[model samples]
Target: MDLLDFARGPAINVAMAVLVFGVLWRLFALLFLGKPVDRTIPRLGTPGPFWAGLREIGRRMLPHPTFATAERFAFFNGWVFHVGLAIVVFGFRPHILFIKNLTGLSWPALPSGVIYAVGAITALSLIAALVKRITSPVQRFISTFDDYFTWVVTIAPVLTGLAAVGHVGARYETLLAIHILSIAVLLIWLPFGKLFHAFLVFLSRGQTGAFLARRGV
Candidate 1:
């Protein structure tokens, strides 16, 4: 098959398989790590672990005041791109159709104009995120190769999706194929990279919350 055919067909299928299995593997491994029994009875009036964990999930969405000043930029920037990405991914007509085809699920799409605008904003936010990461002395000092690589993988689909829509640098067919390929690459890399935090962050935050609540912290 041609590049476009290969990208849309086998490559995407394989990537999806990897994403599903990789995520399941990680989750199961974490589960099998075995929760430690807390001998300390929860302080009187404290919520149970499940409730405390749920509460913590919401609490950790915002920065603690002590670190808010330092974290505010990243937090806001992350929200902008994250929201924009979600809109573009779930609100675009073509993407909705793809979802329907894959899982027999579909939703109404936003206008093409809205999708385009949101996609552009998402790409710009991603660029700002990269700039922030590289320019911040503390963050840059602590950053590893994984940080930058994951960033690239995360942003590739966004950039390519915009490019495909705008028909930038290539014919529409070619641009579309490249966009699909970028998405495939993202799916393949996600579970193996820092992006896996997308799944783990809530779990970790919840566990911490439960632990602290049990101790009456």
Candidate 2:
């Protein structure tokens, strides 16, 4: 099959299956492996653990006062990349169509112009983040194969998407094929490494806070 046909058909299907099942399996394993019986009672007048956990999860989404100064760069760049990425992924017309096809859910998309602008900005942010990770002594020292691999996989879609949008460096069809292939790679990678944090963040935050709140902390 040609690259475009492969990217649009078998590659996408297999990648999506792997993404869905792999994520579900991992989540099930995490939930069931550490099965524990809770026998502790809450203090009188204490907030319920569930609500407290939800509160903590929401609260933690904002920068904490104690660590805000130290984490300023992370908070700023992280939000920029994440928000921009979200817009590009979920607000693009084609992506909305794909979602509608897959899940019978549809939402209005942002203008193509807006999507292009956000995508370009997100691509730059990702590149900047990669450079920082490579150059900073601390970040570089702590980097692993997964770190660099994740960076490449994450950035590929953005670059290819922009290329396809701008009709740069290749035919639009070829650029789109590359973009789709990159996304498939990203899907397959998501459940396996640091990218798992995308799924785990809410669960981790909630569980951590609930555990602490159960002890009246």
Candidate 3:
């Protein structure tokens, strides 16, 4: 098969399958891992554990005033990148069509121009975050190969997508193929790498808050 056909057809199909299977496997493993059940009685006068967990998830999504001055830039850029990336991924016409094909549901898509704008913003924010990771002493000290690998896999689709949209350095078809291939790589990488945090973040936050509430903290 040609590059475009392979990318959009067999390669993407395999990537999707791997993504689904890997994520399910990881989640089940987490479920079955033998952790002792919490036996502590929940504190009276506190929100119930479930509500506390949900509340904490929402609360931690925004920057707290205590750390706002120090982490405001990181928080802002991270939010922009995530929100913009979501829009670019899910709000494009082709992507909406793809989802419809998979799930037999369709949603209205934003204009192509709006998608391109969100893609641009996501790309810029991702680049800035990468730069900060490399340049900041503390961040660099904590960086590892996996961190950089995750960043590359995370950003490749955005870069190639923007390139495809702009018709840069190649035919639009070629760039689109590259973009699809990059996304395939991302799908495969996600369940096995730090990107899994996107799925696990809520679980982790909920567990923490639940535990704290049970202990009357």
Number of the top candidate by lDDT? 3
Off by over 4 Å in 1: none
How should the candidates be ordered by TM-score, best one leading? 1, 3, 2
TM-score of each: 0.96, 0.93, 0.95
> 1 or 2: which has the higher TM-score?
1
Candidate 2 local lDDT, 39-84, one digit each (tens) = 8886666567788779889988889999999778777889899999
Clashing residue pairs found in predicted model 2: none
Candidate 3, residue 27: the lDDT equals 96
Candidate 2 Cα errors over 4 Å, as ranges: 38-45
Q: Cα miss at 184, model 1 (Å)?
A: 0.6
Predicted candidate 1 versus true structure: per-residue lDDT over 68-139, tens digit per residue: 998999999999998998899899999999889999998888999999999889889999999998999988
